[model samples]
Target: MRLRTLLRSSSAVVLAPLLAGLVVLLLRADGTLHPVPGYGLSVLTAAHSALPYIAAACAGSAAWEGGRLKQGRVFEQAPARGRLGIALPVLAPVWLMGLGGYAVALVMAAVAADGTAPDLSRPPIPAVAALLLLAATLTGYLAGLVLPRLAAGPVALVGAFWVMAFPASWQTPWPRHLVGNPITGCCGVGQAVAPDTLWAAGIFTAAACAAALLTAHRATVGTAVTAVAVLALGTTLAAGFGQRMGYDGTVPRAAAELACDASARPRVCLWPETPGRTAVVAQIRTETGRLGAAGVPVPAALTQDPAGGPDTGVLGRTGELSPEEVTRTTAAALLPAPLGCEQPAREPLLGWLTAVATGEPPSDARVRAVLEQPRAAQSEWFRAGRDSLTDCGRSGVR
Candidate 1:
């Protein structure tokens, strides 16, 4: 009897949303810009993540309405071994049903960042988090049946909503990486807090979920482990790594391998490489001028990989910067920040970068020599003075 109740209730709850969510997924995955059904598709795509748990709650409700399945009426009266085995297995499908929507959200989030997702074929954290949250919410819904229908359903809905909303501000490292986050803004999935390694967070979240279920089973209903609840709290209190919440920041993957030594100044590493080289090198000279002006020497290589770069107080190689980036960097190097964009925005720094990135010659090659050399005051560029390279104008400069 309990078996019939479980089967019927679970099927009804999961199948309905599964159908709806599938439609949403299909329409979204289908060719671009269709209509009508396309409208439903878009709406669901937006809120589809929270739908699965709602379905699960409805399943719980269906079981309750079955009368004999409610509370311990029929299931508890059955043999404990068979009952436990059957009950445990029932949880698996709903968790899985939660997956489709989870995948959609995760993928979309990644695409939103970088305008493309890396081929990160690792296990999905958000899906697993969704399953865990769904399972816990089911427990709450089932146990709270004494509440009115309006109250009961709303609990699951609100829960799904909250789970979707909160994790972003708290961007904890491992824990946040383990779960699907709803608060990520338009910023893409891993854009804000990508994990250094998926294995750590994935394994732990799985273990935590298992422990939650096992504890609930062993201790009886009212004594259920507060594992999920506690985990949520922990998520709230967690801090980001270094400064990025444990993520290595938004450094592009291509930023690796950019380097420069004291003898050889680093410049942009590019595709068909040299196209960006002239502009970048010139910008570096301009950028170094800022430090020199302030009496601090700057390096020829303004390369900086926000995630991994030389500790030499230089920007380090952020791989190759485009002509545009060269211009920007040159400007950044020349002027001190808290830049006043208020006026037409003419600053030495801005002019420097603009000149370099735009393929114009820098103001002076002599300045370049001085700036690139370790000794700020002694380099040929500085000593030869600022006017030596009238030809530096078209070379690159702001």
Candidate 2:
């Protein structure tokens, strides 16, 4: 009976955040996601942006568990002190243990689930864990209100973990917005989704909380009610947030236009416009090194005529020092008539090892290594540019 009660207790814990994650996925799935060049910008950017919400999702689970206590369906039972007795031996231990497991499970699922848009890689494990804890703290208070001293907590937690394992719908109303909230999920879409999604999600969350608060004050909380309310909250959060974060339209027309004019492959054109061609050339160099070899396939013009054409890798690695050797080599190839480094369309002038070794000094490398990067543009190239400066007498490699 104890085990059964505990199992039942965990329901809300897992359900809320998982639903929230699902909501984000659903919302963002329909939007535009340009492949930000081979610098891997789009993918990397998506990854970093996604972590905060994942943390929130983890928290949603914890919150769901706590809601039982706060709302007095279970955890708050016993003769005051008796509640502590129940908690130390059974509730608190289980709470911590289960939370760890559920958090790891959810994060692993997210990391493995998608690679295309939501970018599952950016969030560090620790940060996600912290967020999960925060969510749990809020949730625990609610769990206190409606659960039976012996039954509420375990049921909410176990159930919460379960919800995280599958795709679910989610929504929320105010007051208790903390439980079914979807605002965090909106972070996943980047700038792709509509701003209204925020208000929409917030309104729903406010309503849910209000109902939960009223139910608590009226002493109407129960196991069945716990299950229904939490499940509903989780599902709505997942579905609603999914809509907000999921991308919908075409890559901004500008993304396509840039790609076409790039004189490089479609990917080269895909990068956000802020980084200029020279910086792009630097990024190409870096990717080519990662991909290995110099003659990889690219756009046509770059191959046929040099001088920053889109064909065959870009001129220099984005983060590598401005290697005079590479720059000289590329400058010569693209304009052999003037600079004299061309070896024909089929062959590239530089090699992987050579490119890696190229960056020269004004100590550009030092600067790139230390500069702060913008949220979306935090790539090797951006870091490098922050470090780069032209200086006379010195080789231009820095």
Candidate 3:
């Protein structure tokens, strides 16, 4: 078949509308356009959002091509060209359509990010999506060869959709992690997708593609045994790695070199990408000063870095550095770290401290009454509550 003729008859016509719908969905959801802050984040978001549609299209198209070959009795007459050689020309357009859609999605994401340079430290999400698409195509082709011509395309399409979409809703977190879908709750400036997650998805999808290709080429008993062994090993290794990941599929990003405001007491440091660095630093300093004046201890240095030391205070990596947000975060930072056990008074203490630091009335009646005490007595009560937080062995507000 000529390349032009194959393309003219292929499922690219169907895929165009699907890709357009995806674009429209994204645009409607986001509303206004602003450049995404990081390169890795843009790639991750684009590839994940495009995967289901592209995978479904690829699978359906491949299934149709496979059915066409079966109907024409091409396999029975095969002595002129190798099976792979014959299949390659027929499947090439389907592969091109899927990859072309993915490439367009990536380009759109880059444009949204104002063409930011790639962040090398992040996992290769775009490559993972490509591999998964190949797996979908092979699996679909295999299904078509086995099933009736009329039923093959629709069945493959639904099966592909289910494989990509249903795992996300499963109660078992590990299965979702291995499906090559983007991890849930991934990626703020302070966090990245766990490497284990990428490894699992990569291994499982690659193994699936290999097995599907081998089985499609030759359905011999030996080939079946080899395919089963490959799949079993891949599943075992993928599950081993995936089970270690949390439901959220993210981990604290390694600390990067930060821009610091050195002159302030208790120096303030922020990621270089942070907007309005001077205002953010000043707000942090002002809030920490309020905590100190209220007789609450503060960390010697405050940082926005995820990997900051135990003694160092941490600020939020997302959102605007508004005064209220700064005061709440600064006040919370002064609290004792979790002792791996419950501290009964911790909530009340945090509420009281945040109220005091923000110069707002305490919400709890008990906290309000404590605040009405004489200055010396109030200080004593505050000190006692603060101490109780670090000592899980201790109890009570007084």
Candidate 4:
């Protein structure tokens, strides 16, 4: 088929609308954006999630076109151009259209990611999308050559979707990691797509492409053997090295590193990426100093740990605190230990500390009574907080 005839085909007519609808669906499905989180990363992730479907559709379209050519007996004509040359024009339109769809989705995602910077260190997700598109179409073309026209299109579509989707469902790390959607949960500001996961995905898709290309035009025994070997090798590499690191998003080590105010009497450290870094650090330093002056045993330095979680670390949620909240939170963090899981002193100890920090102790009599205790006795209660918080059945608290 000539270029003009190919462009004017019904299959080509449907490409634009299909791409547009997919892009619209993806943008709407990206969900709500929370401030101060990984806006850029999330947008990219949404694009990554949406591209697989588009690639699959393009592969199906390629199969349909291949069927049309075979039905028309174009390959039997044996014209000046070789079989691959004729096939190129037919598949090129689908390839370009698929790429165009991805480009549009990526740009839209970038717009959605506005106001937040993405970690530039993230793996090249677009590269993976390109490989998927190529692999899917090549495989589809091979299917069209072998299967009936009606069967080829749907088979290619469903087959491509299954290969991409099934791996994501497995509980095992290797399967999910090799599927190319490594970071499943929302990409928070502190996270980056793991590099090794992307590499595994790339290798898998690239190998599939090699196999598909070899099998598309010929089916010799040697070619069949080589194709199978290539595919197996790719899967092995993906499943093997793919799991060297966990598929869950990696915390950017640099972002997690403490950024501290050195001049403060009790040094205050915040996560490097904490929003409002300067103000948050200054406030924490001031509150920790106040607690220390009040004879509360504040640590020499307060370190902000985002992964430490609210009740377990010295500081957490620094990006989301008000000045007053900081004072109270800092006091809670400075408690001799995290609120213990055990009882006895739990409520009373928390009450005493809250009153000390806020000057408004809880109205509960149990809490008030702890506040009314002598300073030395109050100190003992504070010191035992960690031990009490420890889970009772485990190794006894140190």
Candidate with top TM-score is 3
Per-residue lDDT tens digits for candidate 4, residues 219-274, read 68988999999999998987775778664645443434467777866667675556
Candidate 1 vs 2: which has more TM-score: 1
Tens digit of lDDT per residue, candidate 1, span 1-398?
37566566664455546544654554355332111121122222233244444434443433333222334454566656553354554554454445554455434433432233422332343444454545443453343344454455456445544543444346454344433332121112112223432333344445545545454355455434465555454443332222343533232323443433333443433222223445555555554554455443343444444342342333322334675565465445333333222322233334433443344555655434333446544333322322222233222222
**lDDT tens digits by residue: candidate 3, 77-127:** 985786666787777777777777776665555666567643535546767
Q: What TM-score goes with each of the models? A: 0.51, 0.30, 0.85, 0.78
Sorted by lDDT (best first), the order is 3, 4, 1, 2
Per-residue error at 180 for model 3, in Å? 2.2
lDDT of 2 by residue, 1-398 (tens): 27656656665444545545554474355432223322222343333233333433433444444454455534345545543343333334333543454344333334433433333353422233333343443344356444554564465455444433222233322211222222232222112223333333343434443444344333444744764576477546634644544433112122222332344333342223323555645554554343232222323332211234434333322222243543444433332232233222212222222233243222333434323334233233322321232222222222
Best by lDDT: 3
Model 2 alpha-carbon drift over 4 Å, by segment: 1-140, 162-165, 168-200, 217-398
Q: Model 3 compared with the native: what TM-score?
A: 0.85
Better of 1 and 4 by TM-score: 4
TM-score order, best first, reads 3, 4, 1, 2
lDDT of each structure?
0.40, 0.37, 0.73, 0.68
Better of 1 and 3 by TM-score: 3
